[model samples]
Target: MDISIHRPESLSGSLREAWHRAADESPGYANPFLSPEFAAGIGGFRGGARVAVLSEGTEAVGFFPYERTSLGVGRAVGLGLSDCQALVHRPGVTWDAQELLRACGLSVFEFDHLVEEQKPFDRYVTGTFASPVVDLKTGEGGYAQWLRGAYPGLARTTLKKERRLGRDLGEVRFVFDERDPAMLRTLMQWKSAQYRRTSRMDRFARPWIVNVVEHLFRVREEHFTGVLSVVYAGDRPVAAHFGPRSRTVFAAWFTAYDPELSYYSPGLIMHLRMAEAAGREGVRVMDLGRGEKEYKDWLKTRELRVGEGFVSRSHPVATAHRLWRRPVRGLRNTVLAHPRLREPADRLLKTVGALRTSGGTGSGRERSGRADPARTGSDRAGPHAR
Candidate 1:
């Protein structure tokens, strides 16, 4: 096989065609982040991105999209703090990993949430982390079965509440692709409000993030694109979700619901609908991102470990940085890993976040009002979501 590289001007026509073809030919198929449009939308800030094509004679066999960075480093295009797959290419195609690295002029490549099935670089990876997932292929029925078997009491109670919600409201209706821009705007508003109220970083405040999400919404491909779904009661939008969808995976990204409708568990209902829609669309997995959540555990059939760490080539500075960074990170992780210290640490963080949120200088009332009194756990929403 011969390998060639191209720097495409735009993700239109032939480039898109090549991307889609390679995506379809991939073993696990295309990841949204691997799509040229996604890369182009977000990669503008990282200098010009390039496409690496591996071909045999006249046929293209593999495609790798990447952004070259200074100091001899490269990252998957559109990876800027996002959690998903990287280095998408044909499954069985074999190339010298080191050669590719050299060709890309990268001394070290860093990734936070690399996909689990990427085998060529397995030896270069240092560690792995678990990302929980929900299998929605069974649809709502399958989810109910899993929940009943895993947490019988919680499942029963939630079901009873669901029934009560139906009784209180006229009828609970779930809609996938409600196609309301107003609904998406509302969801972003609520999500931003939740962030401020909880002393978390506001994602919608970022221009790049807003642009990327809006761009993804308009992008439609067979396996890789953004999907926005909303659930409603009567004419009022109760809950909504925004995420990237592939043929076999619906990566659960951002979600928010009406606080007034909290009693109805709108968020959970939205999840159920998302799963059902995914199954109907022939999707098999609903990647709930990372961290441990009761809902994820309830709906998930299995988990995959993935995380961001660094891999250094022969660069001494990069090697030293990796060595120093890991031990310090390990020590910090050790402290945070303790179950007992978690609560107090979380409370302290909440307090700090509350302070930051309330003008960065506030009296008790300002802080108290912004702080969620019922908040039980740390918001594990990672940097990728932003």
Candidate 2:
């Protein structure tokens, strides 16, 4: 295998095509987060963004997009923002992680949502988490019939709540692809407040992240399209979600609901509506991403595993990087893995978050989780609903 590194912007058309081809052929790589458009979008803002192209006899066969800090610490591209991470490669191709790192000029490469098929980096993974998905295979009866049969309880409860929402507010309606930019702004604001209220880190507070979301909202592509789905009761927008969709997969990224209407569970209603609409539009999977959440368990057809760890070469910088990062991740994983530990930690963080909110100059932010993949755990809504 021949490895070559280049900035996302500098990549030629051939490289972009190869990147898409790799994603298309790979089983789980069709996620929009792993697409070239997301990489390029992130690359435009993040100067450190780079991709390591793996070639076999002069034909590009793989792409590993990442960002490197001055300290030589590397992370999956849009590490916190992206729900999926991988060295997107064509079938039957593999590379040595250490050599791949050397070619990219990085001492350590860290990732939280690495795809499970990445055997090259499997040894480095400390843990794997469940990433839930909604399988939407439209048939004679279509997605609606599949959902009603699979999640009878959930469907009944959600539909009942939606009906009540309609009665209380107005006639409930949904838009699978909302175009209004104001609705986008409304979602960010609601999400920002949710973050503060829960003591979770507010990602929208970051200027770059804000700009990135806004930029992506306007992008409509074959491999990557920003989807903003909303649920309205008459004229009021009660719930909204913003995420990217590849041709076959719609990643559940940022979702927020109007707290004033929380009594009706608008967020849940929005997701149910989204799944139905997405299926009609040709999306095969709704990637809920990796994290534990009661709602995910209730709604998903099955689970896919995602990994978290650091891939490094045998160097001092690599060792030091791992030493500094692993413990922090370990602490988080421990808390999340156990309900006993997670509860108190959550209370403490909420207390801290409350204090920060009162002060109005909050500095604490979760290191990972771009938008709310789920509203539970830190991201992927642990047990937290809406």
Q: Model 2, range 328-363, lDDT digits (tens) per residue?
A: 888778877898997787678768766767756443
What TM-score does candidate 1 get on C-alpha atoms? 0.80
Enumerate clash totals for all models, in the order shown: 6, 6
Stretches off by above 4 angstroms in model 1 are 1-15, 25-27, 44-48, 138-155, 163-170, 316-338, 355-386
Candidate achieving the largest TM-score: 2
- What lDDT score goes with residue 229 in model 2? 92
Candidate that would win on lDDT:
2
Q: Provide the lowest-lDDT 10-residue window in model 2.
A: 365-374
lDDT of 1 at 248: 72
Worst 10 residues of 1 by lDDT: 368-377
Which stretches of candidate 2 lie above 4 Å from their native place?
Answer: 139-147, 351-386
Tens-digit lDDT string for candidate 1 (1-386): 66666663354476567666767776454546556666665655446467677776776666667766666766666664355655565556677777777776777666667777667677766667667776654424554575575446557765665667667765667677656667778878777765665556677888777767776777676757778888766677777888887777777777876655665566666776677667777777778766544566566778887756665578875676677667865654554456576556656665776766676422222121222111211135333423
Query: What is every candidate's alpha-carbon RMSD to the true fold?
Result: 5.0, 4.7
